[model samples]
Target: MEAHSVQVREACDRRAWVRDSDRSSCKECTKGFSLTRRRHHCRVCGDIVCHSCSATVYLRNTTSNVGRACQSCARPSPDQSTPPPAVYCVICLDPFAAQSDALVVTLPCQHAFHRHCADPWLATHDECPLCRHQLSQDRTAFLEFISF
Candidate 1:
């Protein structure tokens, strides 16, 4: 089960979030929300779910997790190596779909994000989020790379 969980975490793009107001009940159990029975979003499919219908998944193999996933997405897919439309802009928690017109950039740390999202972030942070490696201070190289 641990190995399956690892695969599920890797194969699933668990960042796409659903707007809270979009759902009125759990997609799995069809349980309506109340003050006590709150709705939870499945990190994988972005489906609104109940606590019993969702299971906590650790994407980073850490003690803490980003959120829980519904039972459907928690199961490892048969062909788990190939994930679909999974590239996402961590800044906005939005997926970078293949057909999208958004410009994407990959930092030295290998983390990829939309160019628009990353440019502003790089200007302020001057470092990669996944890796603490500071980007080169040379503006000429950076400018040439982005202009491409």
Candidate 2:
């Protein structure tokens, strides 16, 4: 049974993938879409399927921690890749706060914040506000990268 399930999952993963925007109907059941019956994509195969035909699967291999997968691709395939940390400015409580400002600064940990907001906080502290990640190094590399 385990081997059979694995085969089914592998077959699903090998099926033709579709982008989220290109999906029209349920790939598995060929069900025509409606207002209530929304479309969902299988994380592994990227097939647009109906909610009833999809299952919530923990995506251990990809950046998304959890996502919907078709019945055939429901099996988990764990990998060693680490997901990228979510970017949000702690001071402004916004994801694109840095982009809104003229001057932006990114920490060594890849967390970004507006230069004006970060400078005051960084002047007395040596840690990130969001994750509390330590900032022992200077901001030369980050400054050079964003130089306009």
Candidate 3:
């Protein structure tokens, strides 16, 4: 048996962006988007944030590439609850480590992947990679917020 280790990179952008209609305020600042304050998605966490809440940070995947990242993701802080980039796109098994502008997507089953990987995969399988939950069975209703 041989031991192997894999490295992963966090994507700076998400292919399946949280629909503009879905978010009314910046996820970080919680400020409403206005003419002066526009909506920008954080490349790191795929969160919609206002300009003040967004930071132009160096992409973790590449040396020369830079992209917009959210305040929380720009630093290794205490917000571990905020999900990091997918370890690897299940379909391609490609680590996102060096991809500065990769497109990421989150399935209804709660699994995330690179969009390029998920699109073709879902077209053929029509089911989640890890859960095997059929996409056709997913509900149309979008829950605004979860209550614990």
Candidate 4:
């Protein structure tokens, strides 16, 4: 008899896809959006897509995790291990140096910000206020890496 191994799904939170406001139409089809038709996000490219244009796939992680992926994400790509560059907060322009007690948060793009300042801004926009870099999916992991 041959032994079989069952792959377990890794615990994860969904990646924050790009905001719908960034695009007026589906990225894949380039079809214009309307009130009735809603916008969806591709977990891979973080682009706004339509229901017909998106498909769910298990992306590479510790174990394959299900996520809404675009056609591009479904394709394989070279693995990236190098960490992103570290960046200072653009909102305060001080890189959390203004206050010793300030809570700093680092986004996926490697930009850092005061948690208090970033909280309100993040509510309205997903990108960094200064560099306009998109937020990463593994926000918690990034936060853990930078927390001091």
CA RMSD per model (angstroms): 16.3, 14.8, 13.9, 16.5
Compared with the true structure, the alpha-carbon lDDT of candidate 2 equals 0.56
Model 2 per-residue lDDT tens digits across residues 17-130: 686568777888988888989987676677779988976543334332335678767743465233454455568866643233445555534566666667777766656766
Clashing pairs in 4: none
Question: What is candidate 1's lDDT per residue for 3-39, written digit by digit as tens?
Answer: 1122225323445677778888888888888898898
User: How much is 108 displaced in model 2, in angstroms?
Assistant: 33
Clash pairs, candidate 1, are none
- Which segments of candidate 2 are over 4 A away from where they belong? 1-17, 20-22, 75-148
- How many clashes (backbone N, Cα, C below 3 Å) per candidate? 0, 0, 3, 0
State, as a TM-score between 0 and 1, how close model 1 is to the true structure. Answer: 0.42
lDDT of 3 by residue, 1-148 (tens): 1111111226644675677888999898688988899999876777788888865543445432345667777664453344544677677787755555665565544566676666655655646778896543212211111000
Candidate 4: minimum summed lDDT over ten consecutive residues — where?
A: 1-10
lDDT of each: 0.60, 0.56, 0.57, 0.54
Q: Where in model 1 is the C-alpha error above 4 Å?
A: 1-7, 10-15, 60-66, 80-148
Estimated TM-score for each candidate: 0.42, 0.37, 0.42, 0.37
Report the Cα lDDT for candidate 3.
Answer: 0.57
| lDDT per residue as tens, model 4, 97-134 | 54446666655444566677777776666467777865
